[model samples]
Target: MTGYTCTSCGEHHEELPFAYSAPAPAFWQDAPTDVLEPERCVISGEHYFLRGRLVLPVRDADQDFEWGVWVSVSKDNFFRAEELWDDPKRTDEPPYFGWLATELPGYEPGTLNLKTNLHTRPPGERPLIEVEPTGHPLAVEQRDGITLIRVQAVAELLRHP
Candidate 1:
């Protein structure tokens, strides 16, 4: 199977399914309302930032895992995403583009500056992000159409001025 070569880790991957600010999974029903809400992708100035958990499907391993991601979205792509999020009927759009601001783990919150291209998958498949991480990662939890993610961890990333 031909796969995409990851720019971050220099590994060829056959499948890397990821999700953005998707609806929460069923297990997250007991979470606080705020925690159960889908994390918003915010645009500041010309860049967009999102703090949330992404579900990455490992085809070879036959399992899926979650990672806390912080992304800086491109201006044009951010606008496209806004449009898609606002208009549920517009599902034929292209994937949005952004940069992975930090590696999956190891560095302190504000120190890591790992820059890598991150693109959203086409609508309907949980918006896959294609990349690998070093160190420990988070887990995916969703319920009632909201993603139970690291709200505080992601908030710190956006709080930077």
Candidate 2:
């Protein structure tokens, strides 16, 4: 595959990054230092968050684009997920309602606090985040799909931003 020139760094990357990730939820990032936890994927206590992937089909490519983001879930759901964390049957669990907790770049209205459903997968896979059906650009892209040009634009934006 051909590489892309990173506008931000003024360097050429060997390949476009098909997935972008947030180390933690925006809330956790902005929280008081005392409330921060060391865990990268799950945050417990007053607020609960779980990292998941929001996948969007690339209309002109064979692979999908993924946003490795976090979503805020209820305490109960958080605990339940923890209990089933290593269970292969965890995939049978019902999807949990959550608020999108990562603010993705390149969207005008912003990608924070959007309604979502976190669907658990098997033991080794991250939960899949399903954005609620809406007129939001991200949601539309999730439902309809994006072209290779759009994916390249996103790669450039995320790489530079």
Candidate 3:
């Protein structure tokens, strides 16, 4: 259930079914056990569930896009980090750290982590970040430093992020 190749109808689909791209990747956290990276949304092939810490779908909040799902680690390390970037360095050009403010240095707070999956249970099953309040303010803030998050619970968690 994972054959891809359709940057918008190139044709080669297989099991596509992913939909979560907005503003939800500050470093989400929920590591207990994961490893299932299976992306496939080049143009609606769908199939996106990367594991490591990806709960994408945040057309608001702070920002969450560019490979995700990795905290406990599942989604098969999100397809083994894209099969190790599918060799050839996948064109290389990542690892940067210049912009993105709101206190994004080491990302502190136990080490880069942000999460959301509200079904109703902000007590502690996870998903209630907002600086840990259990009140789902949809956190991630800094202001002067830049980092600012809180766009209506990630725009309603992007419908189903």
Q: Which candidate number has the best lDDT?
A: 2
**Which candidate would rank higher by TM-score, 1 or 3?**
1
* Residue 28 accuracy (lDDT) in model 1: 30
Looking at candidate 2, the ten consecutive residues that score lowest on lDDT are 31-40
Model 2 TM-score, 2 decimals: 0.87
Residues 1-161, model 3: lDDT tens digits:
34445444456645433323322223323344422233211112222232222233345434442223222222343344446544544234232111111122222343233342211111222211122223222233321111113222232333334
lDDT of 1 by residue, 12-131 (tens): 656443322323322233423323224334432333554444554443344444555555556676566656754555455554454555444323543233333444444443344433
TM-scores of the candidates are 0.40, 0.87, 0.19
Q: What is the lDDT of candidate 3?
A: 0.29
Candidate 2, residue 22: the lDDT equals: 84
Q: Is candidate 2 or candidate 3 better by lDDT?
A: 2
**Order of quality (lDDT):** 2, 1, 3
lDDT by residue (35-138, candidate 2, tens digit) is: 43332334434778888999999988889999999898998998899899899999999999999999999997999999999999998788999999999999
The local lDDT score (0 to 100) that residue 53 gets in candidate 2 is 94
Name the Cα RMSD for model 1: 14.5
Clashes of each: 11, 0, 37
